[model samples]
Target chain A: MLAKPGLLVLGLALGLSTLLPSEAEAHRRWLLPSSTVLAGESDLVTVDAAASNGLFLFDHRPMALDSLVITGPDGAPVDPTILGAGAYRSMFDVPLRAQGTYRIALVSDGVMGSYELNGERHRFRGSGDALPAGATNISSSRSNSRTETFVTLGAPTDTALQPTGSGLEMIPVTHPNDIVAGEPAVMCFLLDGQPAADLEVEFVAGGTRYRDEPGIVMLRTDAEGRVTLQPSEAGMYYLEVSSSQDAANGQPGRRASYTAVLEFLPL
Target chain B: MRVSIAFAFAATGLAAAPSAAQEMAISVEIPRLKVAEYHRPYVAVWIEDAAGKSVRTLDVWYDVDLKPEDGAKWLPDMRTWWRRAGRSMTMPANGVTAPTKAPGTHSRTYRQGSRPLANLPAGSYNLQVEAAREVGGRELVTVPFQWPPKALTSASARGKSELGAVRLTTKR
Candidate 1:
């Protein structure tokens, strides 16, 4: 039963890509926190969210915080305050009252497609059932994407790192807050609660505006859906993994992508 | 029999301990930069083993005078020290936390058989000093030295911005 929906979503993603070529190539969405690790009494972390062509730069449109999720160390949802969306990016603050890690993510699941009506092709984004009534050559796809980062107040904990078993997710084999340069860190990717094997993961160091090359390190997941990353330098990094399944059994093609902003410190 | 044997070994170990006190003196220089907005940089000084595990945190210089909660908000700006040891420690650590200093040279001394260095094992260690400035840049300088110094040893490194010259001297 679980495999059935996976096949259907893959089909839908393929169909949607063919209908709307521009949407096939998605912009990079990210949530960059001011500090990934903190220690103090009553600390607050500010985060910036955006979908941009430049890594960590806010040249593109703002990422909406409507679907933003903040899971505190106790496995309970925490509300973010001082929320505001500007022209280029959205921002918010999460206070660290607890003594453990916090998971901050912007999760969105939507169906996007296009159809031909009276020989005019019209693009549609939203629910599958919201399509026009009398459209022909209808094609649609379902997309599930998550952009997230982690912040820890004191000692890091795993309660907030647990996977939701929905969409595409990454479970850190090495604690995200504990990543260090020159040491290999492992990350496991899961597609809808199962190991996502053979997926290509892109790791790019931040500060792209000053560099001529993007310096992207392309790595593939192992049979266990894990990737070992050894960052040479210590700084902020952006990681992205995406997968698309071909249309199967007349179902819409499905696409799922995950991105995270990680900070690696020098040993 | 076991208790008597353990006590005998402990007594012998204490008797074999070095009579002269060993100490390390660290000098950190925060360089003055010509910039529009110049805020004093937050600095962290510590010692690490060859494998990069933090052995001791000598000092942390941040906005310690600000409201308790407000100052620590920027502690992570000193990213290297924050990740290595700061994240695991409570803020305003007694005798270790101090206010950020103006652009100049500062010196501190840590003696063996003290709070932080009391339990340190003999090994090759790196004295790391990291400085981070708001609306500016960040830099780190490292000076390596060996414990139970064979002689009066001294080493230093220079940073272009945020930090100046960082020197470490060990005395037996």
Candidate 2:
């Protein structure tokens, strides 16, 4: 759940960080896979990473791939091939050498705050150690975010879907690759390995540029931190959640955000 | 007297198989569509109870001869059947899985005491046939009927796109 008071403080702190432009909040980030499920002795799937105002259009700047992580079914990191970043999107190809699921994610963590140096206020966005020396009145908050998507080679497996217990994450109750339109899919949110209750989630289907309405669905997680999504149509959809936690016991305020790109097949 | 009659019948070596008492026949029609690329559609035929739970999967027509046996990859294209029963069972199931059929009407029959219908309880059930084609659309047709038929019964349904006329008949 989002702490209201913490959000106000975090909002002010975020405003002080000139490094994070307003476009960062308006733009949506996603990872789109060429295919979620595959079969054969060996199959390859291409992926696109981008951030855009129009859902999945890739009209805005390319999402950074510096923190990209690809975990194979065997719980080992797999290197992606044909990795390249263009003006609008970053691209990569992953070979499904083993049969099971693969998780592709981009994880980033940083701090945003302001400090006073010789009576002048300065803003920064990076690790706390990166702050200037002899700084005073340091007000900072930690931010962690993850963007992810899943692909399966043969049979869908759950090993790759396990949460790392580091930041905000989603564990799919319904196999991500098996989602179908008109059927309900359950997903549970966890914050640092615990259920994140009462958090608001935004669900938006792709093809926003053509539709008359954006068709955004607002959902809230239950006490158990689960949300059941029933998409009426088949297409690529994006889910996003962001929340702020108040500072407690001398700890700095914290913000966590999660985003995922999911594809729903027609029934 | 009844014992004597039974003895006489046994002496004559006259006996009927239990399965001969009841039978079910189904006909599925895959329509020919004029399109740029045409491939035989993967089809699934099964029975479901009133609660929509699958009772039996009678037939599954897919590409069983693909190299490396990767043909099952597209099984999910038949989304309805895949979700209901296909995913639960292994592919190439004996007597149930078959090669995809070309555009035409195909028929099959199942006896009451056979592999699939042997233990089906007497109740209201639906005969569902679904077809999904690559680079094409999908269609499903259903026919409702009762098991352990009171008398000769027949029903048929038509599909608009991928499938044509589907008929089901039962006898007891």
Candidate 3:
């Protein structure tokens, strides 16, 4: 009984360290699409993505090109043509032809941000990318970004919107493409094909350009792993959901976070 | 464990089941918009919980009283309510359904618990009013109110184009 209390206390202390505000402020890599949904086949979609300490504040630090992975509505890989890259922002375009949800994910390579511990050099990574064999002496971290948005041509089909067992994905019980602004849309989330309950899924009102703390509404899934949300705005509704787990392989002080952004259009 | 689970389910069922005295009174306003192609907007009034689940629908105003009584065809234009509750309902829902109202405040009270509100559980809810018009913009306004209030509680919200000031009040 005494050992259990000690273990619980230690567990909580470790949890608090991971939730420190500074680390969260440091790694905010998001992909902001011009429109999550395209009205037709001829519609073109543009995205502005970067890795910065601020949200939507372009500081010219573009994400590593190799880290990006784009999937079309049919689950086939689609490549986005890079339009321009400046010091603080990178722009890309995906000519949406298929009429289904497209998912863009970024698994960045480790960025070295080192610190000292106990009079010795200690490196702890934020993202879960494993360090190279000889680079264990340096603390390394990588940020993983996963976002899902749809492009509809004629009529939407279920094939592309279905869950592909991505890290953290939401399968809209109501059709994702057919969401109306005022109606409640139910979505079931899966973390590797199993129901994930009690996760805090935040729904932010879209069209608030450059406002960091514009009101955020949060919903938690019930025991059945479902959340119902009414989109308040008529623009691109961005849902930011993330979860973190301790690193495997007996790595004592490593945490790996999996973050997902679902960009929905409520008309 | 089995008994507790069964009891929990039973409790939920009871809380959601409408009792004898519960009542809901809604007041909807239609603002006369001055436009060239002016048409009465099709309005839908419904109640949804914080989770966005439709608990009950109070009223839906469409072109129900058209020349050939063909206004039911355009009921689908009120997309949100049409998808949730409109499709299942038979046209001209007797005492509950009505034609589009003129620019004025209209009040309706469900004396006996209606189909949707009959099984409403006590929780935070939003009174959603959606209006879509022909040749005009669509507007939606939601007013948040609590159920089973200690006393009468009311809330109001305003809409921009197709909708007017929406006021919702509930009495236990």
TM-score for the A-chain in each candidate structure: 0.85, 0.88, 0.66
Higher-DockQ candidate among 1 and 2? Answer: 1
- lDDT (Cα, 0-100) at A34 in candidate 1: 90
In model 2, the runs with Cα more than 4 Å from the true position are A1-25, A37-42, A72-79, A97-101, A112-114, A120-133, A152-157, A246-249, B1-21, B116-118
Best by DockQ: 1
Kindly report the TM-score of the first chain in candidate 2: 0.88
Best by TM-score: 2
DockQ of 2: 0.27
Which sections of candidate 3 miss by over 4 Å? Answer: A1-28, A39-41, A51-65, A107-144, A207-213, A247-267, B1-172
Per residue, candidate 1 scores C-alpha lDDT tens digits across A1-267 of 122454345446556422121133356778999988787776789999887778879886677787889999999999999589899998999988998999999886777777898889876676657666788877777778888999998779999999998878999999999998999999999999899999999999998898999889999999889999898898889999988976667688788889999998776
Worst 10 residues of 1 chain B by lDDT: B12-21
Error of 2 at B36 (Å): 3.1
Report i-RMS for every model: 2.1, 3.1, 10.2
Lowest summed lDDT across 10 adjacent residues in model 1 chain A is found at A16-25
Candidate 3 clashes between residue pairs 3 or more apart in a chain or in different chains: A59-A88, A60-A87, A60-A88, A123-A139, A125-A140, A127-A142
Fnat score for model 1: 0.65
Q: Is candidate 1 or candidate 2 better by TM-score?
A: 2
